[model samples]
Target: MTPGALAEGRPEARGPRFRVVVETGPDARQEIPLEGTLLVGTQVEGGLRLSDPTVSRVHLELQARPEGVRVRDVGSRNGTWSLGVRIHEVTLAGEARFTLGKTTLLVMPEPTEEAAEPAPRTTFGRALGQSAAMQKLFGVLERTARSSFSVLLLGETGTGKELLAEAIHRASPRSNQPFVIVDCGAVVPSLIESELFGHAKGAFTGAHADRRGHLVQADGGTVFLDEVGELPLELQPKLLRVLESGTVRRVGDNAAKDVDVRVVAATHRDLKAEVAAGRFRADLYYRLAVVPVRVPALRERAEDIPLLARHLFQQAGQPDFPLTEELVQRLMGYDWPGNVRELRNFVHRVLAAGDAELPDTRPVSAVTAAEDLSGLTFKEAKERMVEAFTREYLTALLARCGNNISEVARTAGLARSHVHGLLNRYGLKAGD
Candidate 1:
């Protein structure tokens, strides 16, 4: 969904009384009368007690006036903002929006006698970055939204592939239709087919009644197949048939049922190598990859780390904790082996510890004691250090990519043969 589409709540009226709605947390909504001045802060007495630490005890004061509502910042650490610009005070002639720390406030002019219903909230809205990479991704999404061709999103885990899929759906003509998700990795192979193509009553031992699978259920809509690379080899042909014929044949049923579902698949694995390895079908790969889009890894966009960290910090309810330059530098220097997900977890750990000091990002060999290196020749020690770093790096890389050799190779920018050699040389299994 577009960022603007996330605006929530609306003005409410009770009988002859008018009130302005304030939405704080994800689903918390409150209505306050526009008859008197209201204080918003962390204090218990404030009309709106925002629990965020970035908010001062008396963060903002809003006074209702004949002309409009007057808003003044009451010395908040993070200050206040109107439409994205920082301001100490501003008068709203009518409706306006403002931000205090992590919270957003919408001031509605006194509601009329007839109250309009609030707009529906979108399933996806958070636009986390303004980096060039993100801008390019947005452009691709906008273009893909207008087409019915299948999409293949290539990215590391935690790169927000699912979120992008939702954005594409919300921007498409079928925005009002259902968007179904199928996690191929999580589904058991035995049940994968039945789950994607439903069965008739008594089709199998446990077939209790007739049911429509995700594809049929999502007819006229979109279906996101997450971790599509994990789909079983045996099932790949069936999926390809469905995509080709736009029909599905339920197990134990002869009749083929028509479906009109848009398919969007995502994976961290490199399907080209998978096909070469005889693990995935080349035809299915080509079908799903009509439009391939890559979500850039976090390390490739280090410039966006500060913005992402602050955004995540606010979401974690720790806006008061300063995101120091040292911490940001440390974060940027790290490879972010787990990408955005690891950074988020690191932020949570910092907030939980109530400290801004960041952990060391140095390689394990660099932290080894000098005494432990005694007696070894300089060349021998250097070789050992290189091996140590390589082993550690590959281990984390493999783990983050779900131990898929092709994915690890793609992420590491190494040849499939070279990666296989390294795995053998280091005596490291995919799962290791």
Candidate 2:
């Protein structure tokens, strides 16, 4: 049977709502809202049933508990694994990852509405946003910066996670102290250990003299671990130890010295899935994700696009560039898969082209749409036309309803699931 949504008689409400993300294997990229007790296997009657032969007929079970979700393996041919270790049962209070057969599943508590808070200022530190999502995030950041907890910034590429991390540091009490950034993905793996924990003289061929690592350099301050998911698996333990003990031991030296450092890690990867797949250490994941915050994708807050575009133009020294209503509409209609970075590149391209022949920013006219369909097979042309029409219709519908998915679904006479599928396919995100 094809994978689809499962409906179960509601049990007494227990714990917050949760969703399961199928990261790999069969049904990969599918998200299912989980409620009550969920029975997942290859041959289950109602709950999630996979088509993969590797998945046992009765592989695993998940029951929602008042505290959290309790997951158990029910004696399948292949056992269930969490944190790279086989387990009979485990209770996850927040976010957790586990694997059954060849599939990886990540269970996370669905976002809940919080109490009303103060209105968000249009600008927070270096970041800019006026959307409700941004305002809510600003409130969260305000609270996060007041403390010394290790923060994990999760988001898609080009969503300005690094900027948000720096903003948190600047707003925190550690503003006067050093704020060092360690590009975990850019660092040489062989030298990563020494680079993060410092190295003693003669520790390696390149160690001519003692050097302070990122942790030491940012003593009494904050260290932003950019692209932290790329950190080598072998080095995770050492980093965990530092976070736990507040001390670092230099390479080639036995002595350990104390350092006061706050950690703010940012990553575009699903670290939980990485842990469940054995590519990342579980202990370290817990240590870094003490307070996880997801940075909103650009499409999730399209109203900010015009504001961001003007900011970019001013930054590029092209403040005179005309940002007409048509241009704004065209910009807002795009999916912007690359987020802010893509928008910035687009502004630069327009600047480079010069105003003598400014690029067209108006909506696609019927004549232009027909021209775009030229030189294609009938089937291909039909598909292209359908895609374009669907995109335009959805874009206008979203604007009319203020980015409310439920309203859009009702207005279009489509199921919520169908609407959600369309949104994801078109790279659109409903407002929070």
Model 2 residue 307 CA deviation (Å) reads 0.5
The TM-score measured for candidate 2 stands at 0.59
Tens-place lDDT per residue, model 1, 1-432, is 111111111222221221455545432345566557888888848386677676778888887764567889978888998867998888775445678777777665441212122222322245466666676566656656766757788988878898889888888899999899998876767988988998889997899998888888888899999989989999998998898678999987999999998889999888879987989976577667756778888888888788888889889987776766787787778777677776776676676775444434456666555337667999988887778778878877775665667767766878779999998999998743
Looking at model 2, residue 219 earns an lDDT score of 96
Superposition error at 406 for model 2 (Å): 40
Best by lDDT: 2
- Clash count, candidate 2: 0
Residue 255, candidate 2: Cα error in Å is 1.2
Candidate 1: regions farther than 4 A off: 1-125, 355-432
Candidate 2, which segments miss by more than 4 Å at Cα?
1-118, 355-432
Over the full model, what C-alpha lDDT does candidate 1 score relative to the true structure?
0.73
Single out the weakest 10-residue window by summed lDDT for candidate 2: 1-10
TM-score of each: 0.58, 0.59
Q: How many clashes does each candidate structure show, in the order listed?
A: 0, 0
